[model samples]
Target chain A: MKILVCISNVPDTTTKVKFTDNNTKFDANGVQWVINPWDELALTRALELKDNAANGITAVSVIHVGNASSEPTIRKALAIGADDAYRVNAEPTDAYNVAGQISEIVKSEKFDIVFCGIESSDFNGSTVGSMVAEFLDYPSVSAVSGLNIENGQTVITREIDGGKEVVSVPAPFVAIVQKGIAKEPRIAAMRGIMQARTKAIKVSEPVAIDSLTEIVTFELPQPRAKCKMVDAENPKQLIELLMNEAKVI
Target chain B: MSVLVFTENWDGKFKKSSFELASYATKVAEMLGTTATAVSIGNVDDSELKSLGNYGVKKVMCVKNDSLNVHDSQTYTKVIAEAAQKEGAKVIIIANNNTGKALAPRLSVRLKAAIGSGVNKLPLSVNPFVVVKRAYSGNAYAQVALKSDIKIITLAQNSFELIETPNDAAVEAFAPSIDASMVKTQLKDVQKQSGKILITDAEIVVSGGRGMKSADNWAPLSELANLLGAATACSRPVSDEGWRPHDEHTGQTGKIIAPNLYIAIGISGATQHIAGVSSSKFIVAINSDKDAPIFEAAQYGIVGDAAKVLPQLVEAVKELKGK
Candidate 1:
């Protein structure tokens, strides 16, 4: 069985967000890029499943819907141990367009399972995975925290309102995973990084599609007011402030 | 022609989020000179359905499908899309919760609608259908313009206020055709976390971090949480170090919550951690380092060791509650 993990190139979690072009576009200047944290975890889980020969997972491949500038992120996925990678040559305009591009790749690849992070840290749209499943007419399980192949059947654990539910899904499905899919993302070993330079990163042109939504502008949240400090010795004063001043208690 | 809101019921009872969605949809409908209709799936009774009227819903479509007792995104999408078609709903609103997160994108595809996920406000313009939502985590906001004829919006929880506008809404039964093949996944078991409040649903959260010192120090934090009826959370490092469960981790990579009151104890407020929680209506920080970044985002702060202050705070809460 082959697994395809969809990864996105996003600004590092610590990078201060800025807007350009009158706040219509994200400023990418001097921003560090990394594989989306969730996608990295998904890829790590896929690789772990592949590591165990008993799981019958033959190969794990990574795919991204981005321009050439994101190839470094894609190569980083390769270093983390994907067999190969696919980079759709297009700017990820919106969730719909990105999902359509991914669906095109899934149609040709015929992977048994596809993984997408629940949401990217940038757009936080949380739409692409299920949209891809809808486009492919495949079953999708979201909020997946645990995925295991038991007796050749895929067992999935998803978090719901109060608790969690475990389910079994048939193959060729989408798993929209969140945290706990893997203990932690694996760091690429030196040898793996060396080998990643030689691995094949197939570039495919994006399928023609129009984004359903457009970004009108970007605005930063208003700066927070200076914090009102209460002395540690007078902890009760803090409580009174919460009740009377903040009225949040 | 009308605004449709998908209200999710837990064991046949609607939560605050459902009512908030109803209220939001009503306001949006008012903006567009139309009425708001709500669609409920699962075992909600007529009286319970009519209660949505308290939030300005004029009509409710109740779909009592046994197959949909548990959420299957595919079937739920199909059922909601059919309801939207029947109502000629130009705008569809859903809560940006787990169910909505899973269902909205598929509905967007099925209904050929543009989705504005996690939208925090009403349409900036009704003609163009633009909505504002948090982007780049909570560090920035984006105004999204929907170009499609039909628009689907996932309302961020706690972002909108629930206005009680009683209208005595009419509850009508809705039966959408469900294909058996749509049930692809078999639910084997369910495990509900009991007793403790879920952070996502909690109005207030009391979170700890590495500065809490050790797992043993969580008792006072838990006591404060219990006193205030708040959920307990931890920073990513605390969870990573196994001092707290991964489920309790709240950061950019963990749960993104917007509670009414977030009391962050000992958390230095990394950019990522702040990203997850900056949506909180009010933040109170307690840390030894006065210069911790958390104080910058907090409304109120105490510059002291969490160990020295936590017990006192807990006692103060108990006294305030007359315990």
Candidate 2:
């Protein structure tokens, strides 16, 4: 079975977000870039399936829809055990454009299964995976926590609001995955890092799809009020503040 | 052109958020100088769909199919797209909840419409159609512009108030051309059962992170939640380590919650976790680390061990409530 994992480059969780160009663009000056946490989990899960010889998994390839600047982030994914890489050169202006690019590529390179993090950390749109499935005319599942595929058929478990829902589908489908798919993401080893340095990153021209949305401006969240520290010894003071000052009780 | 609202119903009952979304959509319709229409999907009763008139819906369209009882994002997308086309809708508003997350993107692509998902408020300017959205895990905000004539906006939960202006909304059955191949997926099994309030609806939430130290230490947090009539949640690590149930996990990959009061115990407040709860009306953090990131977002904080502090906090709340 061949697997495809979609990767996104996002600012580290600790980075302080700022907007430049008169508050109209994401300022990437001092921000540290890393693979999105959700995508990392997706890649790790694919590797685990490959390691265990699940479904005769032969190869795991990675894809990213961004310009050459995202090469480092793609390299990190390759280091995590992706067999090949493709960087669709584009700005990824919106989820629709991103899905269109992937779908265009999928028509040429057919894979048995496709995996992507449920949402991107930067935009948190949570729509790209399903849109890709629609563009490819493939059945897709969202926020799948557990997955099992066998002989061209798949059964997946996903979380509903209050409980879990288990569903069955045929192969050649998309699964947007989250936490329970893998306990811990695998770290790159020395040998894998060396291999990734020489791995060929194929840059494919982006297919033009009209982007419907744009970020016109950006603003930081309003500064939170300073914390009112309560004496640990006098625990009742905390309750009093919640009652009188905050009035949440 | 009219404004179309997708008023979703869960199970057999309508969610309060759906009503709030309907009201929000009505306001958007007023902003656009048009009428607000609603489409009710799933196993909802016709009476409940009509009740949206109380939320300012003027006309309601009912889409019924035995196969639609289970939520299929693809089919729902087709249904909503057809409804929007039938009504000549210029603006389509949906709930930015789980269902919206699933259906909105596909609909956006299908209709070739620009979308503003997870919008915090009404349009800032309707001419170009700009809306404010949460960015970078709620630490920042972004103004989005949708240039398309047909626009879709998914309003954030708890951000918009549910306003009632009874108009006796009329319900009519509408059929969208659908083929057997259109329904590509089906729900094999569903295990939804709720005893306590769902986190999305809870006014108060007591969330524990890895600082709780062990799975056994969760009792105090649960006890405190019980005392205050709140739900229990946890950080990603707590759930990842199998210390807490996965459903209780609240973070970036987990549930994004916006309760009235959110209390964090033992959580260090990673950006991922904070993104989910930052929109909460009030925040209080109880952690031994005085410099934990939770304190930055919290209005009140205590530097004490969660195990030692949870019980006392519970007792104090009970006493204050005269329970």
Top-scoring candidate (DockQ): 1
Clashing pairs in 1: none
- In candidate 1 chain A, where is summed lDDT lowest over 10 consecutive residues? A160-169
* Kept native contacts, fraction for each prediction: 0.88, 0.72
Per-residue C-alpha lDDT of model 1 across residues B58-100, encoded as one tens digit per residue? 9999998678866788889899999999999999999999999
In model 1, what is the error at residue A148, expressed in angstroms? 0.5
Model-by-model DockQ, in order: 0.87, 0.69
Q: For residues B1-323, could you state the per-residue lDDT of candidate 2 as single tens digits? A: 99999988777678888888888988999999998999987667878888899999999999888767666667788899999999999999988877787778788888888888888788998998998888787778888899898998988888888899899899999878875566666567888776877888788999999889999988878888888889999998888898988888998878888888999999999888998899999999999999899999999999999888888987897888787
Q: Give chain A TM for each model in order.
A: 0.99, 0.94
Give the number of the best model, judged by TM-score. Answer: 1
Number of colliding residue pairs in each model: 0, 0
Top candidate, metric lDDT? 1
